[model samples]
Target: MATNRSEKTVSVLKIAAFAALTPMLLAGCTSIKDRRGYVMDQALTTAITPGLDNRQSVEGTLGQPSFASQFGDPVYYYVSSTTEQRVFGQPEIEGHEVLKVAFDAAGNVSSVTTAGMDDVRDINPDGDKTPTLGRDRGFLEDLFGNIGAVGAGGMGGGVGGGTNGS
Candidate 1:
């Protein structure tokens, strides 16, 4: 009767709803691939010559570097990375490259070195606090620790120290 047709309609609607949502649910589990930093061009990078290429020509060849050395010899670092990330997950480096171009005192390229993921190192710090020679202190100790230290160190002419205020 009419009840049997209504039940069939409800079942079909349920299937249609699931079909519409199946792709969306799968999309959440899919990984997102991203490329960050400098895009490497093999031809242009290889064209850079140590003795021939200077800062200006190098910049023209490879564009601006990711960073440069602040001290010591002038070195330009071109860094690139490809990472994959899932929903609510940290991005993992799938590929990484670092090109180091060193310049001599004359600002001409001295050396060109390339590093891959094999050179990448994960540095896990030892907890949040930096290890120090001093003893560990609590919250209240830190807040009030300097209370007596300021005047305790031979601060002359205090209440009980210098000739009792003669």
Candidate 2:
């Protein structure tokens, strides 16, 4: 009887242990991770040697950049990021990289730059309202500000005849 009771207690403990750990175990299964944006491989990135690799060579080697600049030498950007989300919460950036390549007028690679999370800057906005060079007024004030500004006077004087009939 004693041995049987001890076995039963052990079984109960095992059940409790597993029950306590079940949530965490199941949570692990729900963790989602995604590798997004420009896929940067070491060998592929190293293959691009500035001054040697032109637009054609670079594109042929690593494909199109994530984006390109609008002006100047037309900088090309390769961005990569890894996001991790648990359950239904917002995804968090686990890794980030910004690779930039500047091309000269001849389309030859002029410079290569790389940035990571370490280079990220935190921006703390001052307030909700955006500051602009204009007078700030309430909604009602704006709605009524131009109400009486324009005169209701119909067209300049007369359009041919008023009292002269000519």
Candidate 3:
């Protein structure tokens, strides 16, 4: 009985140790701050004015930009992304904030503008809401259309329907 008790105690201790250390181990792996350094570097590179120095240079230090325009005046964008992840799962974006800064000919800050969650547009903005081009058919119409020849099965006829008109 005493041996069994000692074994149980040891098992409990191991489980407790794992429970405590699991978060630390996982936190080290999933911490977003580690990944955020690169974004900060990019922002600094694009945002820094050529002639300006110190606070004046960083007056409009934006967080993160979603995109930078490739054409015309070089546009710097700052975007802030919040993501959530579960253990052994993929990370999901929770929120985003964006700022657009345009630099003029001299490379000094020209204009600073900020946009938030509402400013972003969906990739498929009119996905479900947009009306279909053709006459909207009922579910049964679509189902039957899929099963028969005139329903786009082609002139080859259909399964068990025979190739030639007998």
Model 2 reaches what TM-score against the true structure?
Answer: 0.62
The numbered model that scores best in TM-score is: 1
- What is the C-alpha lDDT profile of model 3 across 1-166, one tens digit per residue? 9999999999999999999999998787763421221143455555565445332354446434456689998677766767777666677666665556777766666666666568767774555666789989989898887564554656654567674655
Candidate 2 residue spans exceeding 4 A from truth: 1-29, 142-151, 154-166
User: TM-score for all predictions?
Assistant: 0.77, 0.62, 0.38
Preferred candidate (TM-score higher): 1 or 2: 1
72-113 per-residue lDDT for model 1 (tens digits) = 999999999999999999999999999999999999999999
Stretches off by above 4 angstroms in model 1 are: 132-136, 143-166
lDDT of 2 by residue, 31-90 (tens): 799999998898988888888999999889878999999977778999999999988689
What global local distance difference test value does model 2 have? 0.88
TM-score of 1: 0.77
Clashes of each: 0, 0, 5
Consecutive 10-residue window with the lowest summed lDDT within model 3: 31-40
Candidate 3 segments exceeding 4 Å error: 1-38, 42-47, 50-65, 69-74, 86-97, 104-109, 112-130, 146-166
Q: Higher-TM-score candidate among 1 and 3?
A: 1
Residue pairs clashing, model 3:
64-78, 64-79, 65-77, 65-78, 65-79
